[model samples]
Target: MPYKRIKWLILWTPTVTIALWEYIRHTFLLPYLSMDLGNALAPVIVLTVTVTLVYKLFHLLEQTSDSLQRERLAKAAFVEREQLARELHDGISQSLFLLSVKLDKLEHTQDKESVQATAQQIRKTVKHVYDDVRQSIASLRSEPSMTEVQWMQSVEEMAVELRLGGLQVELDWRLTDSDLTSKEKIELLAIVREAMLNVQKHARAKRLIVNAFKAENISAGGFNCTIMDDGIGVDDPALEAKGRYGVRMMRDRANAMGWQFEVGRNDSKDNNQTVGTVVAVTKGG
Candidate 1:
């Protein structure tokens, strides 16, 4: 039986049954049965029915709760797997594409210096792919309860890596541990990392800045993270020719976390020249 129907039955059955029993005892059974005997049996009958109904109701509730819990776990696992697949497509796949392009160049080059350079580039691409795979594995093994300091260290490590590539990187982080929830922090970090990688791979800029702060006017949660680079602006033709999966993935991550994602050329103080590109992810306003 449906829980609601059983609950209603349990509530009304005892009262109605006792009322009818009393009516029959007084109106008809009084001739044969004593009032004391009828009254004495009424409590026992009510107790039996009440106990049975209570047990059934509790059992149904427990079963419902357990089913809901299992559904939640299954859904969470599916989402995690989907995210890992996307990361592989965006990170490792892109590196392999670069490696293939370098190999094509190596095949056509005749000069010894050019051939050596192309081979070096291929080696770097292969190393990058290896690192990406290792990072993905590490992420899967990482604890969910990552501290704010650890997150900051991760961002700093990314900046250091960019520096090794000869890009000047700056960090201006102002968020505290309480600024965002654990899931929010994770998604935001992913978006930032994607932006930085795009700059390192395609921006052709000398300097980059990563800024994170609270801005009530710009975000509902008063939180925002921006990646600004003095690279070829967003209007560059080469960017469009390259696939936009990285940008699309970053936008999807922000949207999934209920955040706002925007990418455009930075506003220049001097209107005569275009500046670098800027990518911002903000808590939805």
Candidate 2:
């Protein structure tokens, strides 16, 4: 039952029970019983009955409230998934159509260099679009009930779908014993998805690794998540100009969740020219 309703019930239940007992006794039972004796016996009977009835009613109300809450949540999840599906259909479908037209033109054209470049560009665009659709589907299907381990499993599954040079993902789960709240799991999953999507779209790296570890000099339950890829290093100044909203969005999400977000080039330990990108997030417990 709602708090207000329960409050009112508590206030009025005793009053109504006593008033009914008094009315019954005055109208029909005073002649058979003494006033003092009737008053004591009537309250006992009225109190017992009131207690039983209130217990049953409140139990039923609580059950109904729980059922309604679950139903509402289910409906909301369904609507969100449907909206995501429609957006994917509209965006990816158009891109695929344009890609088909380009492929057809390339097949009929005699120009070698132009045909090769167009084909390569179309291939990259197709892969990026496919990755986007997969990520959207994965996000829509994800549930807050998932635990950290289960969330990581889902991430691995999504990684398999990337199919970038058979992109190998190494997960270093140092914080496996840690417990994360449902909201934390969802937010962390979103950050991971954005990171992986960036790798799929721009990294062009053969290997990707995600490391989860406890953060140093932080409060209890603080942890850090980092994704490293041997891709081209990011240019901080040109990122926004290059229309890379994914990185910005990830940073914004981390900040909103009170996590520290960092993205930059992974310094080469061996001093080789093979620079890479690193995206890291540190969150408090």
* TM-scores for candidates 1 onward, in order: 0.54, 0.48
Model 1: runs farther than 4 Å from truth?
1-35, 47-63, 86-91, 97-114, 134-189, 196-224, 227-249, 255-259, 264-271, 275-278, 283-285
Residue pairs that clash (backbone atoms under 3 angstroms), model 2: none
Q: lDDT per residue, candidate 2, 1-285, as tens digits?
A: 565677578567778888888888899988998989987887697779677977766776687778879999999988786556544543364346446656766787688987887788679769867876776667645543554246576566546445422567777767653556666776677678678767766788777788888767767878889988877777778567656656766776688789989888877642343548888899764
Clashes of 2: 0
Every candidate's lDDT: 0.76, 0.70
lDDT, candidate 1, equals 0.76
In the range 72-174, model 1's lDDT, one tens digit per residue, is 9999998888778776865687567557656766888899998887788778879889988987787754534565226676577667657755688889999
Kindly provide the TM-score of model 1 when superposed on the true structure, using C-alpha atoms: 0.54
Q: Residue 142, candidate 1: how far off, in angstroms?
A: 3.3
